[model samples]
Target: MVELVVQKYGGTSLQTTGRMAEAADRIIKETKRGSQVIVVVSAMGRTTDDLTTLAGQVSSCPPAREMDLLLSTGEQVSCALMAMALKAGGVEAEALTGPQAGIITDFSYGDAVIKEVDPEPVRSRLKEGKVVIVSGFQGCPGGHEVATLGRGGSDTTAAVLAGALKADRCEIFTDVDGVYTADPGTITGARKYEQLDYESLSALAELGASVVHPRAAAAAEAWQIPLVVRSSLTEQTGTTILPGTWSSCSFPVIGVTSETGLSSFSLHEGADRREIGREWKNGLCPWKAVQHVKNRLYRIVVRNEEAPHTKSLLSRFGGRPDTGRALVHVIFRSKEGKQKAGSFMRDLPYTQDCFMVETQPHVWSMDVPERHRVNICQALHDRCMEKEAAPISAAH
Candidate 1:
């Protein structure tokens, strides 16, 4: 039996016709190596952002269903272009939308969850020696209209397909080489991690690492799928994420991650907590319920990008929004214990301005001004992540 591989290319990897051609060549090269390849692609360049801008121009608060319908077109366009590029390169290829490829998701409009995937069509295409190109980030359920997964959702799409198909590997091609000690774009001396466990990567993603999607990391972990994140434009080995355990001695601080464009919403103590909780649970806006509450106020943190929609949803229940907040998290092995971690946090350059601090077994997070995020990240990296730490062996 031929080996099977599921590969996902990010928007930057397929940004231009020339880049698409390069990706096609990569697929064909894999096929020549005796592996059947299934390709999943995200919208090219800033297509999704452009679509959102278009929607915003039409209405400040567009209906979720209609926005999904409009946004889903971006991936479809990428899929079609990729197929064309593959065909032009003399490879038999066919492009498929998520639904056409048998991805069944929940009816959550703008943030659909993939419940199941029927791999028959993809298998048939493979048997016919045709490379299958799939549109990522969009899906449809039995009776509902088109729906989209949230931002960075293409990663989830690829991982889910890989699991359902039981592929040998899932390769995520991005502009960056791999997961690093910090956002390389912001931190000058950030080092690339050659390998990481699913849990570590998931934490980074949740905290604000753009390289890997949190949901995608979770799905891959649940399915026990092997994941390789590499640069599409370079020959770097990238990083591998799989199930394992590591010693604290070898890996102290995995990375420093910060999220800007964050906003906090608070409801008065007397407000209906039950209704607020229900609305938050059922609402489309992405938010994290903060454990710390002060002065009888219930607080939730949301991405600044989604602040408008989140505020709109919260307004129905009388919640107030506070925009322009930021969070910085320093991630490390939990074995270090909270006391040691708390000490590390205290040692950072500036702590007087930090309004809130949360320390977990493996992560230490603090609330700070959006403007100070980059400086904080750099400071944390210089203080913690830059030092040489013992390497921990991963338990297979």
Candidate 2:
């Protein structure tokens, strides 16, 4: 069987002129191994922010639809640079926009979900022995309007490609060697995982592991696609999100990931509480849910980066933060211990009595306790179990 691989290069991996060339060279080297290649590239650096700034200047409150149009340029610039890099490496490569690549999505503007991918052109180019470079994270649905898949979206594009093309593996090239136990910059003794299950990977994504998108991981997990997170700066192997990598490892949380600029909502009002609790929601839209309370007092979590806007958003509706952090660990717990350990979750909407989200043996979870001066993590250390781990291989 012929081998075809789908690889995604994040913004940091394509930050500088040298990095762009370096990334292209990596893709070209893979192609030279007699395998077909499909490459996904993000905007070189803060191009998305630059575009956002321009969009805001044009419209005080930029519409989501138009913002998609502005942000699509990020991926285009990346694709062009990647194509140029491939050409410099003696590879016959062509960069195609999301539409040109046939990535069909729903009508969502800023965060569209991929619906279908016609891989005919992609496969044709590969059959003709050419490398195909695609602009990730943006696609069109039912018309000519450009749509974006939101931040950290390019990773989803690559995983979707792997599922559609049935590639050998979806290799994600980023700055880190692989998924680590923590940010490494923050926590001590943060180890990297050789392999992670899809469920665990999703947990990490929610916890701020930038290596993969939860939506993309969902797609790959649904199709059993092998997804690898490796460093573009080094030859070392990264973490692989696989099916049964943790049949033995009993770690309840595979990694300690954090997110900053978070705002937690604390609702307190009898009138508001009596109206079926129409407020508190968390995470992305799909992950959103309604919160029910006997009283109006409620809490919601939001990114600190958006706090200024969030405060304004809530001020309009009588919202206030009980307290928040510039950054948070966003911890994880296993289903096995959900009821025993996180009984507080029963009071919220997303959380139910013993009703937990999907999880793996190696998974991550988080929650906020009633008491602010609490650390739920002291028990996480007890989650580590003795298993037959292979001798730790030096990253290479």
lDDT of each: 0.82, 0.68
Cα lDDT tens digits for candidate 2, 1-396: 668899999999989999898887788778778788999999988889888888878789998887888889889988988888788788899999988888999889998999999989788888878889999998878768778998888998899888888998999998888877656554445567887778777777866767678898898898899889889999998888788643344544454455544445544454354332333333222211123344443444555555565566557457675344422232334564343333433333332211222222333334343232122232232233112243222222
Positional deviation of residue 345's Cα in model 1 after best superposition, in angstroms: 1.6
Model 1 pairs in collision: 250-390, 250-391, 261-304
Output the TM-score of candidate 1. Answer: 0.87
Q: Which stretches of candidate 1 lie over 4 Å from their true place?
A: 246-249, 264-300, 304-322, 359-361, 389-396
Clashes of 2: 16
lDDT per residue for candidate 1 within 1-396, as digits (tens), equals 788899999999999988988888999999999998999999999999999999999899999989998999999999999999889988899999999888998988888999999999898998899999999998887765788999998999999999999999999999998888789898978888777888888988988899989999999999999999999999888888878764523556677898777887766667565666566567665565353464343666778777888778777556787777888888877555344545767777667656454434577787777878898888877777545442222334
Q: After superposition, how far is residue 30 of candidate 2 from its true place, in Å?
A: 0.8
The per-residue C-alpha lDDT of model 2 at residue 197 equals 77
